[model samples]
Structure formats: structure tokens, C-alpha cells
Target: MRLQDKVAIVTGAGSGMGRSIALRYAKEGAKLVVADLNLAAAQTVVDEIRDAGGEAIAIEVDVSDRVRAQSMVDAAAHAFGKLDVLVNSAGVGNIIPFLDTTEEDWDFVFDINCKGVLWCSQAAARRMIEQGRGGKIINLASQAGRRGEALVLAYCASKACVISMTQSMALALAPYQINVNAIAPGVVDTPFWDRVDAQFATLLGLERGEPKRRAVAAIPLGRIEQPEDVTGAAVFLASSDSDYMTQQTLNVDGGNWPG
Candidate 1:
């Protein structure tokens, strides 16, 4: 019960890493705001938490929309009295060559991955500051952020921005005792990767799972990662365990990236 009585909002809680983190937080005794673009999906996660005897609520939000982002914070605060932790996990990506990348593609990815984090963190930090008790903001970066890839230019850049923004946010919010950190996960076996694998397959002229197979083989740990593999770090960042830590990006990448 490391997070007993804490209030947390997990964006993209409808699926993948975000859903896993939300469920874990609820089990650790935190009241959760399972925010996602898909209201139905978020409600499903909320239902699971309730069935497990944990407290949670679901909200639909487009994090890139400043108004919706602010309303999300307001809803969380209104639900549980205050904000304690915010996990910016809503994101999108596409596989395209550098030259083939269009502005629409870039904006589609950046809107959710970059601008979304900014708006949500801004709203959350404002509420946390008003609460006068410090808070935690955990972002989901990617090993792709550590290096450029031929087929994922926009996504890579967006995640790299997340890492940079994490550092800047840690500095900006340190005066309020808020800790900001990020997790850079490697190739996790999530539904998101299913889309990525398909895109890679079409682009590289390989089989449906070949790109992912190669990625897993390259991991020194000898396995593909899972959403659960990242939960421990997420929990640490969201709880008192990381009170003295900030501006750091922990690599949950199984030695995929040397950072």
C-alpha cells in the first residue's frame, strides 16, 4: 500500500501500459481517475478496479485539448479532493520514412504524445501547487527516444521531447517539492506494438511479426518486455519512494539502449 490514500490520474488508462499502471495504483490503495480518449474503455478499467474493491472513476479526455485537459484535472480534484500523481501515458505513433512523413502524421503523433503531455502536466501541476503538498508526474518515454529510427521519425522525436520535457518540468516544479520523472521502455508486447509491427511489416517487406522478433532478439535480456515490466518503476516514481528523485529517465528497456 505504498500509495495509500493518494489520488492519481492515469491518461490512456484504457489500454496497454496506462491501463496496467492504473490497475496497479488502485491495488496499492490509490483512488484513481482512469482518463482516456475512449470513455468506454476507461469505464471498463474502472469497473475492474471497483470489482477488486478499489476506488476509481473514469473520464474521457483529449489531452491535447487544453480545455479538456484542464477539465480533466478539475474532474479529478472534484472527485477525490486533490491531485497527488499524474501519469501522462496517452500517445500515438506511425511508421513512415523520413521523407514520407507528412505534417499531418507529425501533428497526429505530437498532438497526443507531446502537446498532450504538456497540457495535462500543466493542469496537474497547477492543481498540485494549489494543494501545497507536492506531487508526482511520470511520463512514458521510449527507447526510441534515445535514438533515431528510419521508419519512426515523428514518434522518436516526440518521445525525445518527452524526456527533455521531463527534465525541464522537474526543474520548474522543484520549488514546490514536486518530482517529475520518466520511464523509457523498450519493445513491450502491447496492442500498440501490434500496430507498430503491422506498419513495419508493410514498410520493410517482412512478415507480420518479423520486426518485433528482431527487436526481442536484440534485447540482452532475451525477452520482449511487458506492460507489467514497467509497473514497478511507475509505482516508484508515483510514490514516496522517489521523493528525492527528479529530472531522471529510468530505462526499463532490458539493456536495449545504453542510456
Candidate 2:
């Protein structure tokens, strides 16, 4: 119970890495706010946590909306007693060639991946500062952030922003003892990747799974990553284990990218 009695909000907790982190936090004795753009999906995760005898509530939020983001923090404090951790996991991406990338593509991805994170972290940090209890903010970056890809310009840039933002946030929030860090995951087998794989297949004239296959083949771990593979790092970041750590973007990419 590394996170016993902690209150944590995990954005995009309806699915993939976010959902996994929420469930794991609950098991570790943290009360959870399972938030997602899709209320129903968030509720499903909340139900799962309750069924496992963990405390949790579902919240629907568009993290890019500052009002909604503020309300989300208010709701968490209202439901529980205080805020202790926030995992900014809500994000989006598209597989567009660099030349073909449009402003819409950039906005759609950046709005969620970057702006969303900013709003939520701001809201969460404010609450934490008011509470006077040092807290944790864990962001989801990507191996893609470390390098540019031929077909993922917007997404790559957005994640790179996340990493940079994490560093800046860590510095800004350090005065209040709020640790801000990020995890850069590699190719995980999640629904998000399903969309990515489909787009890559269509764009490159390859088989449906070919792009993903090639990605997995390149992982030094010798296997495709799973949502669960990232939960351990998420848990550590959210708990007291990382109290002395801040502004670090950890590579959870199975040696896919070197620092």
C-alpha cells in the first residue's frame, strides 16, 4: 500500500495506460478519480475499482477546457478530502506524413496532448499548494518525443512538448514540494495503437499489423509492450518512492530510445 490514503486523479482512465494506472492506484490504497472524455467509459473503470473493494469515482472532463479542468479538481476534493496525485494521461495522435499534416491535425493532437496536460496540471498543482501537502504529477510522454518520425510529426512534437513541460513544471512547482515527472513509453499494445496501426497500414501500403510488428521487432525487450508494463512506473511516480525526483522523463521504452 505505497499510496495508502492518497487521492489520485488519472485522466483518460477509461482505457489503455490511464485505466491501468487508476486500477493499480486503487489497489495500492489510493482513492481514485477515474476521469475521461467519455463518461461511460470512466464509469466502467470506476465500477471495476469498486468491485475490487477499492474507493473510486468517475469524472467526465475535457482536460483542454480550463473550466472543466478546474471543476475536475474541485470534484476530486469534494469527493475525497484532498488531492495527492494527478496522472495526465489523456492524449491523441494521428499518422500523417509531415508534408500532409494540417493545422487541424496539429491542433487536435496538441489540444489534448499538450494543452490538456497543462490545464489539468495547473488545476491539480493549485489544489495541492492550497492543501500545503506536497503532491505528485506524473505525465505521459513517449519515445516518439525523443525522436522525430516520418509519419508522426504532430504527435511527436506534442509529446516532446510534454517532456519539456514536465521539466518546466517540476521547476515551477518545486517550491511547493510538488514533484512533476513524466514517463516515455514505447509501442504498447493498446487501442490507441490499433488506430495507429490502421493508419500506418493505409499510408504505407503494408499489412494491417505490419507497422506494429516492425515496431515490436525493434524493441530490445523482444516483445511488444502492454498497458501493464507501464503501470509500475506510474505507481512509483505517484507514490512517496519518487519524493526526491522531479523533472525527469523516464524511458520506459525497452531500450527503444537512448537518452
Candidate 3:
């Protein structure tokens, strides 16, 4: 197993990309903390991992809450004695145009997408420092962060913040031998995308699936991304293979963002 004996915390593990990364980690022999805002969903992942003979625990956490994030780290440490990896995968997206956006919309995006990352990274880094074993922190950024998109102002700004924060975190944690990185994915075939598409289908004059079809057509790879497509990158960053790499946002969008 590539991650034998490692303990990892994967937020938003209930569904979509987060769930895939959590399952991949478990299969690689890592003891996992499958965290999600939805308790039942998280538990389902835990059950799946356990059934597959992997060790895992499910925790319901609203990552935007600093205290809750800290408690999550405490729970992980209490369960497995140490935390070797932290994947900040819990996030939400907004597709509204800038003119139609509201304060609540902006705050909501920042709170969960940006501030959530800060809370989780801080909490995990503290534990890693205490353990003196070093650690890996991976943030889920987006192509929107690299450059502006047609809509989704709040989401774009928040992801840009994540990219900046990843760089800052890598610098601060480097002295401790901890590596920090971010993944900027364009579009993936996930449940979250279905939800996002549903939200704006009316405005686009098409259904959720139509927009996704168009997105896939736009990708140079001739297909939209799958959750597993990102797991390879996640494992790389979380393992020693990427020990020398930090403070970088690797685009996993199948050449959608050429810049």
C-alpha cells in the first residue's frame, strides 16, 4: 500500500471528488477521517471503506467553523494517534453574474470555500507541528482562480484566495518540513456539478446536462473529468513523491486553462 499506516483527513468526503479521494486513500492503506457536512453521507463512506477492509471514521464537520475544524483534528488524532495528511476538499460554487450577486452569496462562498480552508489547514498544521512528523496539506482550488470565468464571481475570488493562501502556507510550514499545495481543476463529472448546472439551467436556456455536455465538448481531452482522475494527483501530493513540491496549484483540467 502506498500510504500504509498514514492517517488522512479528507473533507467533503460524502460525495463527488472528495469521496473519491477518501476511498483512494483508504485503498492505499491509510486510516481515514471521512468528513462531510452531512452525517449520513460521511458514514456511508466510512462503511464502504470498512467493508473493503480499510480503517476509517466518519465525522460531520462544517469546515467554516474554526472550533469544529479544530475538534475534527482532535478526533482524528485521538483515533489514529497522528495525522499525516489533510485534504481541504469541502467547498461550494456560485454561478451568478456579478451584477446579480448579493452580499450573502459572496459571504457564503468565502466562508465555506476560503475561510473553511484556513480553519482546516491551521488546525491540522498545529497538530502536525505537535507531532513533529511533518505533514501534507492539499487545497482544492479551481481554474476560475487562475483567471476569470464568465460568471461565478464569488467562487472565482474565493478560489484565487485559496491559491494565494496555499503559497503562504507552504512558506510558513516549510520550516517544519510540511508541504502545502493546491489543485485547480476545470470541470469534473461530479454530483456537485450536476447541482451547479441545475442552479443555472434556466438562465442558460438549457438543462443541467446540456451545459455539462457543452463543457465536456470544450475540453481538449474530448471528455469531462472523473473524480478518480484527480485521485492520482491527490495521492502524489499527499505522499513523499511530492515532498520537494510546495506552494503550487497544479491544473488538472485536461488542458482547459492553457495559460
User: Among these predicted structures, which one has the highest lDDT?
Assistant: 1
**Candidate 2 lDDT trough over 10 residues, lowest sum:** 234-243
Write candidate 2's Cα lDDT for 1-259 as tens digits.
8999999999999999999999999999999999999999999999999999999999999999999999999999999989999999999989999999988999999999999999999999999999998999999999999999999999999999999999999999999999999999999889999999999999999999999999899999899889999999999999888999999999998899979
TM-score of each: 0.99, 0.99, 0.98
Off by over 4 Å in 1: none
lDDT of 1 by residue, 102-199 (tens): 98999999999999999999999999999999999999999989999988999999999999999999999999999999999999989999999999
Native-vs-model 2 lDDT?
Answer: 0.96
The runs of at least 3 residues in candidate 2 whose Cα sits more than 4 Å from the true structure, single-residue gaps closed, are none
Checking candidate 3 for backbone clashes, the offending pairs are: none
User: How accurate locally is residue 155 in candidate 3, as Cα lDDT from 0 to 100?
Assistant: 88
What's the number of clashes in each of the models?
Answer: 0, 0, 0
